[model samples]
Target: MAVLTGVSHAAEPLALCFAPPHAVAPDVRSQWQQELRLILHHSGYELKLAACTPESIELRVLRSNPRQPQALGAARTSQSRIEPVVEIYLDPLAELIGTRLAGPLGRAMARVTAHELRHVVGQQAHHQGGDFPEGYSAGLLLAAKPAHFRIR
Candidate 1:
């Protein structure tokens, strides 16, 4: 597992904790991390692997259930009196093998991760609609390579 902190000076502090899939290759995980950082960076946030800090938003990465229906990823807030945590399931993405999305798994995973992070930072689950919003899809952010990502 790895812990990452966002840009400190930002108005809201954020941290990302990643629990890599046991069966996944190390190189693939590295690629995902790289892409995740780059994608998040474009959103004007910095990420560093470390322990959770005071008042920092917490997010986690875990493997999803394979026995269930197809789900590329899922994220939700874990309500707690102390600190709430956001979790993103990755087993579904990890299970995609020899398929059309296999080639872009890393980028796809990054997109999913970015989507979840937006939820934590925005503190809401609203999508702008019209196909793909800021957190809903990476086609615009990752493909178009915008100067910065706006949390809408």
Candidate 2:
């Protein structure tokens, strides 16, 4: 699963919408949605609580069988070219449920998603280098816990 890390400019209003598969548990889904909102709020991005359209950023959490748990979050420039569409995916059970390390995993997802959005906004490239001034560091997002969720 990919997490959203940070945005290029916080002042620009951005929308975050979840596109989950129907198989997800209600409780778990709610938790994930709440966590996403909290991450956006604390990170200083605007959360548009509407359904995803061509103009909005879409974040998804799905189950997959990979060697290691991972996330795939990316941002794409929209058709209008005014805002970027950020997409986040995560290993459903691994990152969203309450396991021993779930807190860190969720935080990581948020950070990675943010990173992808930055990429979409032309703040940073997929790869990092001295030339990329807006590189994302996962450590920053994990530094704080979500406002509504606790690790313990």
Candidate 3:
């Protein structure tokens, strides 16, 4: 599931939209949004909530497994000639949460979102490693606590 953000110029504000899975609690979604904002802020970016379309980050939810792939979330960089569309899968996160209803899935998911955004916003065509500007290993990003990556 790719959310399309048309060619966003530097002059336009960075905006985003939560696709579906409307069933998710507002507070949970808000919490996730706040987490993402904090992460992006530390990375030197501002986030704005936008409509479902017309140039914005589309947050979409997908089945846990899209053919038993290893990645928990993926971003579409080639979808548009310009800005890429970001998508995060919920199934793997659900698996990690495993029967624990109180697990930090929301927080984890937010981290995944931030990881993808780094690729799109940072204009980084390739990942450095398991960290961000430092490098990014999806596995490490998903498994570690948010505190692990401190703000500079």
Candidate 4:
């Protein structure tokens, strides 16, 4: 079943729709998109969110998450289409910047986004560890290179 499931999505591109928060600087947003593109591309995924076309996955960067305050983001299968919808809270991720971890909000957002997308794409029943299920690491998020945020 797992093998079949993996095969089913192997050739499909990750066509997602998401926009950066309005408050972010244009350069920051552009850099974030490029960084995430590098990560996903290196990990064997194609990112099509820039076009913002209607797609199977949608991501939103919300002001805050009252239900799960500490969490950076979450994902759920959309009830209407059974597709994945991802929600990321900007405040919590923004707070991490300049802390002991020390990182930019955009990079942190990308890291969290990558993690949540994996659960939906993999249809993971359990987070076996490493990146998913497990919390994001400041070290990984703070890294200069983008290849470390692997989806699988």
The TM-score of candidate 3 is 0.68
Q: For residues 1-152, what per-residue lDDT tens digits would candidate 3 score against the true structure?
A: 99878855353356888777644556656767777776766555677877777677787767554665556666676644325567777666656555213235566667878877766666566665445543345456546766444322
In model 3, how large is the Cα lDDT of residue 72? 61
lDDT, candidate 2, 86-112, per-residue tens: 545455334443342545555556555
Of candidate 4, the 10-residue stretch with the lowest lDDT total is 2-11
| Per-candidate TM-score against the hidden true structure | 0.60, 0.49, 0.68, 0.73
Q: Could you give candidate 4's per-residue lDDT for residues 1-152 as a string of tens digits?
A: 34444443343467877655544556556666776677788678888765465555777878678988878878865543324777877777776554412236666777787878777777764567645546665566676467666677
Cα error of candidate 4 at position 77, Å: 4.0
At residue 81, candidate 3 shows an lDDT of: 38
Sort the predicted structures by TM-score, highest score first: 4, 3, 1, 2
lDDT (tens digit, per residue) of candidate 1 on 58-130: 5555566355445544445456322345554556554443222433555556666666566666665565554
Model 3's C-alpha root-mean-square deviation from the true structure amounts to: 9.1
lDDT comparing candidate 4 with the true structure? 0.68
Total residue pair clashes for candidate 3: 7
- Scored against the true structure, residue 138 in model 3 reaches a CA lDDT of 44
Off by over 4 Å in 1: 1-13, 19-24, 53-59, 65-68, 78-84, 94-103, 130-152
RMSD of each: 8.1, 9.3, 9.1, 6.1
Angstrom error at residue 106, model 4:
1.6
